[model samples]
Target: MTKFKKRPSKLKKFLGLLGPGLVTGASDDDPSGIATYSQAGAQFGLATLWLALLTFPLMAAIQGMCARIGLVTSQGLTVTLKNHYSKPLLYIMLLFSFPAITLNIGADIQGMGAVAHMIIPAIPVSVFCVAFTAILMFIIIKYPYQKIAKILKWLCLSLLLYMIVPFMIKQDWVLVVKNTFIPTIHFNKEFFSIVVAILGTTISPYLFFWQATMEVENMAQSKRKIIVNKRVLGDMRTDVNTGMVLSNLVMFFIILTTGSVLYNSGIRQIDTVDQAAKALEPLTGKLTYLIFAIGVLGTGLLAIPVLAGSQSYMLAETFGWEAGLDKKFPQAKAFYISIIISLLVGLSLDFLGISPIKALLFTAITYGLTAPILIAIILHIGNNKEIMGENTNSKFSNVLGFITLFIMTVAAVALIYFLFK
Candidate 1:
């Protein structure tokens, strides 16, 4: 008699489920995002810690819908919009998207370079920036999707340092617990601005494009004979939910670390990742500071590719050119060229005299304005029976999607009012 095969362990099954969703969610807490969250914690203390809990469900819901669209349509979101929507509509999105994504890349690169310079004062920030740029470009051009994805997955380990930080220093467990569960709102422009920044940074527009497109790419790279079925969608949800939870947890801990250490130490008005790291060195000691700074560099390594890849994919899809990270340079010349150009442009931002802090703030503003519109579009597509067929969003997804849309729309309006007020 044949022996029965042993089942795979639960932990192995969980690890196998991680993919595009994992990368996409981790990339959300890029250097720029860290700076935004740091600024919130530094300025307002634990007032914003509750946002991490609130955003997880909202973030997971939106990403889950995008992933589903990619699996069902077997096309990038840009291509779907081009095929089904008006030309001007698609172009408008690209116009808004390209600048924000490039600025974000430049900001992340600058943050990483700044933190690296902090670690090794002998090396210049410019040199570190150039070297990191070259290394990332080489990796993207040289490796296939699976290898690069594995590299990113490992890079995610760096974010856990943020979670490890608050434990190193003394934390008021009771106060932390109280602040996390209880929402606090201040009726002022400054407080609202940080709130908007947090919203814009966490619920970014770039991740939307990346999530849908990478889902398509992830499927293409899979060795198994896969089909878009309930199991597949279920796996996608698990991956996305797990990733978003990780992303939000990192955000929570960053705020907690900064809030407990810096705020209590009378430090406020922190700008940029380097500033946050530098402040931590004195207050929380060298070890905590290095961990925080190093996480910035790791996130840059993980995120810049996502930013550059998403931009390149959008351009490729808009123009009807072949594009995939799994494809070689000769196979996808336009796509690879676009990625290279975006990296070069981002690298030039510092040489052109733009500050990383300014880049982060401006990028947040741009996203705050554009993200709601994209959410509206994603919601429309998710619910479109002609497009999604039988896979249209369920009531649970629709409820979360509408809630996200409503909240983001209100934030966008508040942002505009604040900007012009």
Candidate 2:
């Protein structure tokens, strides 16, 4: 009994250190995320699972830089950009990012309503969209930031559902194992398209804004001022590495679960969480369906606030108004108002009768377009000694970061050409 108690106590302490990274990483698998993963599995089978491995280090480096920015400056990305870069550049970047983030929040709320439609079919998605947006607003506007973060942290545990189901489905261990290591590129339009989408989704632009701001939130939680040093850099690295690794692992399982269950059975489309859940039933069993549903609900709860908060942060920072969930609503009226506006905008999109699946994919494509520029800014900021002090990026991290930026930029260009042409 003493041994058991001691181990559980140790686990709790470990988890305490893991809060921000886990919540951010897990939220990466929101309904939009699930849709992306499901589409990859349904369309291409396990071919793209290999890309998750490639993006892990790149994602970690970028996120680690974002965390360090906050720890060093105690300010969010938009604020820092305004101070560090020219105003015209800042506004131009925001022009791309703000609309993308706002649309994404709308898409996420719409996805949540779509999921709710699964649980109660008669209830219209638009009504649930409004209700869900209102509930998230109350939570953010009415509650403490720390409490919201904690709730998201716990809600994040729903990710394990996909992890558990993949194993239970009993896949071709040899093939799954083979695909994990071997990289295959078909080099055709569709293959390149999927590859681009994977990069876009994994290394998203909004995530850059969200991560940097959350770092400020984390610093606020620690009640620490901006103190630049190597130690803070080290801590930021650990936080990001832990988060990115967990995120990629979850990505792996999402692909594996869908590939094993859906692709193997010739199901080529997954439009909603409900479709994915039903598709998982025959291959992975009903228990897995329940697990998938639970994961959806949990991710929805965890991600909606993040979606809203990123938009709020951008809007607040761009205008020079007081912001941060840590500040009381009255103290940060612009911040809270931005959140409400984003919520309403998102809810209205759903009410307009746009298909949730289409909204998610379109939003994802928008992220694809906007992500590379954000990545460039992040890498540039990370290398700045004034901002990072002695905590500037290592040579190795810089090398990988540049490679990621280059690849993503090229992909973004190609995606735009292909889409419009």
Number of the predicted model whose lDDT against the real structure is largest: 1
Write model 1 residue lDDT over 1-421, tens digit each, in one string: 9999999999999999999999998999999999999999999999899989889999999999999999999998999999999999999999988888999999998888999999999999999999999999999999999899999999988889899999998989999999899989886778778877888888888898899998988878778767788999999999999899999999999999999888888999888899999999988788999999989999999999999999999999999898999999999999999999999999999799898888888888788778788888999999999999999999999999999989888877876776678
Task: Tell me how many clashing residue pairs each candidate has.
Answer: 0, 0
Deviating ranges (above 4 Å) for candidate 1: 1-4
Candidate 2 Cα misplacement greater than 4 A, ranges: 1-13, 223-226, 417-421
Candidate lDDT values, in order: 0.91, 0.78
What TM-scores do the predictions have? 0.98, 0.92
Q: Show pairs that collide, candidate 1.
A: none
Best-fitting candidate, measured by TM-score?
1
RMSD of 1: 1.1
Q: Estimate the lDDT of model 1.
A: 0.91
lDDT of 2 by residue, 196-272 (tens): 76776678777778888888788777754656576656656666787788778878988888887788889988876
